[model samples]
Target: MSEPKHVVIIGSGLGGASAAAALRERGYSGDVLVLGSESHRPYELPPLSKGVLLGDAEEPDWVREADFYADKNIDLRLGTTAVRIELGGRLVHDGSGGEYRYDRLLLATGSQPRSLPVPGTDLPGVRTLRTLDDSLALRSAFSAAERIVIVGAGWIGTEVAAAARKHGAEVTVVDQIQAPLEPVLGAEVAGVFRDLHTEHGVGWRLGAGVAEFAGGPDGVRSVKLTDGTELPADLVLVAVGAAPRVELAHAAGLDLSDDGGVCVDATLRTASPDVYAVGDIAAQFHPRYGKRLRVEHWANAKYQGEHVAGNLLGEHEPYLSSPYFFSDQYDLGCEYRGLADPDNDELVVRGDLKSREFTAFWVRDGKVTAAMNVNSWDDGDALQSLVDNRTEVTPTQLREADLAGLG
Candidate 1:
């Protein structure tokens, strides 16, 4: 295959932005065009929920400095959305009635926040953190909010609860699950987050689903739980989850998985060799896990963006890096490495959970599958190596041995 003359990326978030930069770094002098629906340059989303919401960060976490795109000769079109993909013609149609031909196409459209189906969500005080603008608006609301009710006890909800509490607002989190992040981290491990939020003066209404929001013209007044309990609130955040933006891919006849993303092989190439997908919109086959995973995290977007750039240039190497992510809530900052089905994996703790400083590992068949360090920042590389190398170890070694010295 020859080097592509024109590489067009749909979506200007981190994944698309990183790919554009990586392509230039790899000496691909092709015409690199990045189309983003947002009016701003490519930025990271993690800060929107954490630093931006807390008023600690004032600017978007630009994927690269603002001048890097133009300096690298990457044509980044902000406030533009790719609405249609003509796979047969190798052309993309934007929402503004513009079409561009591409020698290679990468779709990194990413995902959108999931909203509650219940009524009153359209109220003025209701919000969902996704973009830079949303975070700024939330920051403003947090300053004046007397009570904040966050729906869904996932990462976003928990983080928002922390920020709101820091603003001196009465925060209450509602979720249908018994514990926050139970499905992903398991009840015992997820308990760490629950304890963290509780200790931070945040309230919880777990194992309960939202019924509706009772509001007036000014804004939402209170949240009504399915159990008939009414919690007064000046602001409500629906943080259930996100759905991948795959309408263009679906319309173009790309193979979509039941997981709700475009199916791609090890190299992040879709069914069509000239087309690729990454970030939240890509259900990529992980060589390490021997399965397709659609990871929705900052690390996935950053790493996959770089990995797919090589494939776009015909490198054909498989992305072997394990799934990783980090989160910061209040004073606690942590990094999580690898994928784990907490329900079946054997969990082992290295430090004290109550002390708010610990390392938790999930092992399967005597091999560490995933690990999380609550406040132990130095254990990141060791944890990554343990999971990436698939090193076998017993519960005793995991709990007692120094991770840096472990096999």
Candidate 2:
């Protein structure tokens, strides 16, 4: 296809903003229009559950400066929603009846936090943290709340528990799984988080699920568990998981994965010509994993956005970066590189888990498949190199910490 005369991007999160900046950086002088549903400009969401909720950070860390769009002649429309995509005519219609014609289109609609279908979920005190406004409201709620009940033990839930405890609120986290974050970090590593929260005075109710929530005139008053135990709660946060926003893509008759995300090829191109999807909404084919995976990390969004922009400009390259993400809870900071099968692979630990300073590597077929460093710094580059290069090493070499500089 010839160079696009006008490109319209839907959603204004990190992926959308990065793609716009990347296009400009790569010398694409076409008309760029970004449609955002939120009123604020593009900003990072990771801090919402951590520093922002704890009152440590007050400003939104924008992906780009406020004047970046105007300075680059990029048309940015905030507080507007893309309601429909007319692929036949290559046009997009917003909620306000505004129609935009485009030669190329990008979808970075991201995802929305999943909510509980149980009763009292719509109570006044119930909340879910996703955007900056949600975080600010949660911070204020935690300030006045004496007791806080979190419904999920995932990353966001654990982080919120830490912030709530820091603010003197009695925090209780409940989950159906035996260990929190077991699905991602596995049982052994997830135990570290469970211990950290317990030591900090955070309560946990594992192997249990919420039956219902009872509320009074003000809001939620208590939570009833499946085991028939009722726990009092002044506030409630449901952090189960997120569902990708694929309504627009589905409406356009685009191919979707069984999990509801847009299915894209290795180049981040959807089945439709001149159209692509990135960020949490795109389940792109991953060569390393040998399967299509949808990653929700901030780094993945930024990297994929830049790569998609380059591909649109004729720099054909497969999206081949390994998955990476990090989490911060209290004084514990960790970075994970690469993907590994939790059921398979041998996990080797270096350093002391008791001291909370350790690096864990997953070895499969004598190759380092993944590595994670907790409470450590300045070793991500080396760790990532090992995963990317698929360096072969024995169990002794990994456990003895002698694979340094091997990458």
Error of 2 at 128 (Å): 0.3
Candidate 2 backbone collisions, by pair: none
Q: Write the per-residue lDDT of candidate 1 for residues 1-407, one digit (tens) a residue.
A: 78899999999999999999999999998899999999989899999988888888898688899899999999999999899999999999998899999999999999999988889989989888889999999999988899999998988988888889889999999999999889989998788889888888888999889999999999999999999999999999999999999999999999999989999999999999999999999998888899999999998999999989999998898888888888899888888899999989998999998887999999999999999999888878889899999898999999988888885
TM-score of each: 0.98, 0.98
Writing each residue's lDDT as its tens digit, candidate 2 over 322-378 gives: 988888899999999888776687888888888999998888998988899999876
lDDT for every model?
Answer: 0.92, 0.90
Cα lDDT of candidate 2 equals 0.90
lDDT of 2 at 365: 95
